[model samples]
Target: MTGRKLFKSAKFQEVNTAVKKDGAAIFVDKEGQENLIIDNPYAIRYIHSYAEDTPFFLGLADGKLRGTKCGACNYVFATPRGNCQFCGETTKWVDLPLRGKVHTWTTCHFGGEAFLKETPYNLAMIEFEGANSVLLARLKDCKEEEIYVGMPVEARFSPQPQFSITDIWFVPAGAGPGQRSKK
Candidate 1:
């Protein structure tokens, strides 16, 4: 109440871009008053353990999509899981087909730091042939207007695996339409 304005702007440009260079970002509030926000850059390194999901990440490295199946209920997961949701049984790693249809999709206008550079990208939930669920991934090589439910897509993996989910994505396989998912 004593400092910054209570209202915001469309782009929230508190001040002109040329105002300063000491890690201060400018913003113009709704009242047309310039405001300055401090900005800083930092980085860190940490060890990671895939644990039970090691197979899934490793599968991506091998150009494969690995999902877990409940041996007791036969329920298939598009994303690997350690335990089954329906039967509470241990799941087994299984290979999933690379090609699938887009079950649902959205065009992202905003994203986190990792995807900020690729804002306005398409994301899709792909439905595989035998999987009961869908895999969520970035849809590449296509425009937002070109995306639709049931659109055919195929898995694409990074040539150099980073052992992360970003290692996998999907690209347009062909142009065709299928029925949209109800739910």
Candidate 2:
């Protein structure tokens, strides 16, 4: 059976809870089964909250790109650090343009156990406008043959109704912005 189908089985979501936290509702499964945890610091830092600056997810919801700029040294950070990496000063929030270019990318044939049974997906590192750092997000709306280094792209959000929050995804802008394909 496919990983998606296996995950969709009744056994997987049996003890799931739709709990709200910090204005965002999330699905909490208590069945003691292995599942994807996207927000874990060891996995990926989804928000800038680890440092107190605005997170990229929030910026995507508001239709903007947000970053942290050092108030003391005027240094801009892409991961939105709380303090300047260079000067160790408090970082200020800054809004960035939605436009960006693909810096690097890879197609994943195998992910966690859940995705192991499914087809491959693409992940990309995108460098946004006015920022010296790159952001990592899932890439959508284009085939593998069409993706290239330095390709222009934009950020898009998919609403997760169960959680009442939006998940950010990226796609090629020239092909058509905001287009997503089913996994």
Candidate 3:
């Protein structure tokens, strides 16, 4: 009952809130449900250093797939981990084989705004021949009925990418493993 009616904004008209002892806001809903809300959640900022995974994004920009390989255990990771999961040793960047097979797949019927435009797209867990880590990439240029557990796929880079996972997607391979180009 001590809470007062706060000023109204276009988005939040009935912005009735109470100030807590620690300077937090308690938002009361129409049904008298009280919820503590942060005043400026977006005010906090963070600076992340993706130093280890730089090569992965850089390779995508250059139309080459890259991952990290363990020097100690000889394990290759498609996610570009700085250290090996098996041996806990330092890893070295290596160009990953573009050709792989769909280890598993699913058609996404619903998604967020960015992906909603491309609704019903297929995402697949692609397994490379030499790498232990599997790359999860969007399946493109193929039909749902044609997709199989072991269907051959090749990593395709976007002509102009924004330096994220969206830069690369997988498509039906032009040829099988033995017939694919080495480079």
Candidate 4:
């Protein structure tokens, strides 16, 4: 069947049409050749598995940075992996220093809807003192000219805890430990 003739068929009209911003459209057949487009991707229609990073969030609430150490190889992870990337061993909880040096950083010009109000923010890979792993965090309280590689910084927490990574950020070092976000 021709493309136009098949698209105009009664069965095709009943199927949802996935249209893109560029004016491209798609119709899924019974075999599901077309991709499913969700109207509200953020809406929670069902519960999924949760992340195993609860300790990391809890530590932030308690004004502390936490990581995980592999029991077999002693590999430290700032992002708190469930298993060691090297030795395939279970990891244990460990406390990370609040202070660190910026391994690398970038100023974000765009962000998600929740972060649209705070666009042009800074994100950095901070290597905490005495830790081999580098943690990714939002950088704050400094101007664009002030950020640099190997710049010293310390972790800061939001006054109102959200138990998420957003609860913590990094600011220029010597700003004191567990500093609260200015905004």
> Clash number for every model?
5, 0, 0, 0
- Give stretches of model 4 more than 4 Å off: 1-42, 45-51, 176-180
Q: How far in Å is the alpha carbon of 160 misplaced in model 2?
A: 3.0
What TM-score, over all chains together, does every model reach?
Answer: 0.73, 0.63, 0.69, 0.71
Local distance difference test, per candidate?
0.80, 0.64, 0.77, 0.76
lDDT of 2 by residue, 1-183 (tens): 122212223332232321111222223346645444222223555642433543655555566667788888787776677788888898888876677888999888888985687458888888876787777778877778889999998877665422212366678886665456675
Pick the lDDT winner: 1
Model 1 lDDT per residue over 1-183, tens place: 334333346454433332234445556666787566665557999887999999999999998899999999999999889999898999999999989999999999998988787787788999999999989998887888888998999887887889988788888885333422111
Please give, for residues 1-183, the per-residue lDDT of candidate 3 as tens digits.
Answer: 335333322124234233333345556566666665544423556676668788888889999999899999899998789999888999999988999999999988889975787778899998988899898889887778999999998987877778888788888888443332111
Better of 2 and 4 by TM-score: 4
Model 3 TM: 0.69
Instruction: Give model 2's TM-score versus the native structure.
Output: 0.63
lDDT score, candidate 2, position 91: 81
RMSD of each: 7.4, 12.8, 7.8, 7.5
Ranking by TM-score: 1, 4, 3, 2
